[model samples]
Target: MVRARMSPRVRQLALIGLLLAGIGLVVIGIIDPGAPAVADVQPPAQPGTAKLAPHLFEGPDGPETLPLDGAFIANVWLQGCQDCMPSFEAWKRLYEAGEIPKSLPIVNIAYGEVDPAWAERYALHDTLLVDSDGSKLVKPQAITTFTTLVVAADRKIVWRGLPRDPGYLDQLKSALAALPKD
Candidate 1:
């Protein structure tokens, strides 16, 4: 039997289509194709709101003091939490944004036993306080997962929550913004 021949134009189009399809698939994969179609993950907290940082958690990061006032953010996080790692990134964004006053600190009260070297994950080892023992600073009711506290210069509590909490950063920023303009 004789075989049919395809035109050069058709072949070129097919090749081009295949190439484009491959590129598209790659892009999707890199962008997390397996991620839910909808926004399943809640966004990070905003800059202004109630904060949760109660006391200090001693760690290798020196002494991370929770923000009490003067336009600052206070985050309480553990060193080895997978979830806190990402939130720590978010904290970087918030700090780099120049919204937090220099005096305002991001205190990570690390509970449980952990290595001091982990403080570098959040770039806070030199600038924050670590309270290994939450017995004194953290209240029985204030305890939570990756808790973050946003306090204004007036010593007001605006935001608080774990990394997964909605609007966690917002409460932080809001509290900072509400500070008494230094």
Candidate 2:
């Protein structure tokens, strides 16, 4: 058997190559983290009219309608969607940082039957609208992607897209800032 040892220069080159490869992987992962397992539904086109169906959610107060009289943030998600985690984190951070207004409503719509315990475990504490069968609100919205829509008081979608996108968040901030104070 023959034993071979690489020169110091060769070993350093190999180590540097591995380090570069690792950094590249990290960068790629950060740039496009991709989406969660999305439902097989078609999203409505951009600038489409948006309206919250009457009595869409049954809250503690009773059957409720989404307030269309002010700018609000609506996050649409499905149960067990792994990709929604980033969106959740982004919103949480924004909330903690006070980037999201305390007065502005953060509406979370669960597209399917979600356990109350599941929500508690996930810390989905918001004004939740449960669309357990996708009949009332989900189907009507034609929601597809894991989306966060900034809706104006007039039922116009001012900004619509992923909640985790940095650019989207910036756009959201700008849109919210432009909304007339109630």
Candidate 3:
């Protein structure tokens, strides 16, 4: 066996590199610990295939189990997510522009305790639900700062992804259009 040893300068440089990498990772974690790395993020569930479990959430009126008897859109978001507000704003814009149908409700599902004032802040007249029971049902399936699921009457998730995803607006519009006409 041949003995090998790194030169002192090389060892010092390697140590410095490792320290820098560790600091970078720490910074990333501190800035956004909940965010998953790009490669770790799973693609959104296939439309019309995934099923969302019905769970009790605190709504404006009272506690209610979601997936409310018909097709609707669920916007799942975390409490402290910086990206969530922008997404909510975009949704508001879509609704105000008449791109989103009035009959198709958009439910805001907050992953943790949420203030009722969020509805007023976001200018959302639809239901705002808080995961007050701690079921955390949406957390397992949603790995991003925000997720939008278009659920059908049967509870099947007809569409799932961020509202800003490419072609997402068109997909959402199509899904809403396909809902049984009242």
The prediction achieving the highest lDDT against the true structure is: 3
**Candidate 3 off by > 4 Å:** 32-43, 60-62, 132-135, 164-168, 180-182
Q: Which residue pairs come into collision in candidate 3?
A: none
TM for candidate 1 is 0.49
Q: Encode model 2's per-residue lDDT on 67-110: one tens digit a residue.
A: 75677877777767778777767766766676665558877777
lDDT per model vs. reference: 0.57, 0.69, 0.72
Kindly list the per-residue Cα lDDT of model 1 for residues 19-124, writing each as its tens digit. 9999987998898664333344444344343344444444443544454445555566657767666676766665567644455655545655555566664555
Clashing pairs in 2: 36-83
Compute the lDDT for candidate 1: 0.57
RMSD of each: 11.9, 11.0, 3.4
TM-scores of the models, in the order given: 0.49, 0.63, 0.75
Please report how far candidate 1 places residue 144 from its true position, in Å.
1.9
Candidate 3 lDDT for residue 169: 84
| Candidate 3 TM-score versus the reference | 0.75
Q: Residue-wise lDDT of candidate 3 within 1-182, one digit each (tens)?
A: 99899999999999999999999999999997865676765565677767777777777688777756788888777665787767777776776777776566778787767766766565454678887533455545644567777788888887776755667688877778786654
Clashes of 3: 0
